[model samples]
Target: MRKALILSSVLLPAITAAGIAAAGSEEKPDVQTIVSKANLVAYYQGNDGKAKVNMVITDKSGNKRQREFIILRKDVKDGGDQNYFVYFHQPADVRRMTYMVNKHAQLDKDDDRWLYMPALDLVKRIAAGDKRTSFVGSDFLYEDVSGRSLEEDTHELTETTDQLYIVKNVPKKPDTVEFNYFTVAIDRKTFVPMKMEFFDKQDKLYRVIESKKVEKIQDFYTVVKSEVRDLKKESKTEMEFGNVQYNINLGDDLFTERYLRRPPREAIR
Candidate 1:
């Protein structure tokens, strides 16, 4: 087993399954290869998919904030990044405000972000190059959402409970994420992540995410509902997605920078 482990680690993609390829560098499939392929299979299919998301965020003491956000995603172009736009409408202070994310492939490159404040009628651009910064103060960092490469992390198959495959992910990149590691429980049948838990850099569990209501729309299984909890604060955030349709009539103009800056009725085109 040790001999097979050493050879698999050097192969790059199949490093996650070192034991299986122990005998020789003859190229047996590994978990990393499986994960990479599954991600690609799901990634490209959702390009240019638009959905109306209804979010209900609750703070401590059961105080709730409800809002609706429009989300649109575009394909990865020029090996640069995937473009996405968001706008929230609801709750008193944050209605009709827009947020844009320009996620670059290179972690060091600038990930341009902006938020248009309706009260100020001003668009504030968030500067990039803050590696230690969070994504607008969320528990997740910019790299967690933007960096799609699975090779940056080491994945281990922990166990199988009922019908789920629990995989623990630890980042290989130094100081990349604020968390020690996280466990993602994927549905064995669909390869969809059903639940996740994030641990702080101190190796303590920080947050837990549970996803339910998985459904297939336009040939993809999408998580329709999810809840996130902060272990330290006893606060939680719940998000529910609705009108979730996919792979339908998304044109090139839908991904243009002009539309990103000024979203029009033609956004779903």
Candidate 2:
């Protein structure tokens, strides 16, 4: 399951109920279980979901840019492989641009990503190394749009509060990523990740992702608003999700490269 921050999806009520029940129990869950449950709550909502997102990018000097897009996601398994499709709708320069990802659960297999530029009439494959780069000039990275692999890090239960469970994650291979370590505060009842703080190599806090608004949709908890702040750059991106629907039964064919060149009707609609 991918870490959750951007884009919204309908969560499974069964899973949320189970998590709440476990939280009420006297025994505290292990760090791994807690992380796993948080992942599911963040990314794996219903089998398939869709949402329209409006993004506002603010720079250090306070200049702002806006973007609108539609994001579609389908899970092959509840907590394993998945697929994501995103289509741009606003900003004439990026209109009709599309991005797709084939997320893999295996540690050895990297996710496949592609970007479509309508103006250039070109399809570009995004390499694994570039996943951490800014996404569409926004503060959120390509990896953030989907999520980072759980196996890539070692998780520890650093602190547990009355309402939140704090977990610190250190990359198993620190050299591969930018951050030295990150910590997430997970809601005890819903298992939703409320805040995440990233530390640089020098142990300086440099980045943060926060879930600003969460609402229960279709009897499941969903993040409708979120923000990502880049401290060093003094920039931030705020995303608001609307028209979110779950269990849409989206077809797999819609995610193919063929559709990348020409978006499916569902995406444009």
User: Using TM-score as the measure, which candidate wins?
Assistant: 2
- TM-score for each model: 0.75, 0.88
Model 1: pairs clashing at backbone N, Cα or C within 3 Å: 4-22
lDDT of each: 0.63, 0.86
Q: Which candidate is the best by lDDT?
A: 2
Give all candidate RMSDs, comma-separated: 6.7, 4.7
What's model 2's overall lDDT? 0.86
Give the clashing residue pairs of candidate 2, or none.
none
lDDT by residue for model 1 (60-149), tens? 777776766777767664223667677766655776778877666554466677777767767788776554454334433445334444
- For model 2 the TM-score comes to 0.88
Candidate 2, residues 1-269, lDDT tens digits: the string is: 34331111234445555777878656666787787778877888888899999999999999999999999999987667899998998888889999888988777888888999999999999886556889778999877777776788999999999999999999999988999999999998899899999999999999999999999888668999999999999999999999989999989998898999998787776
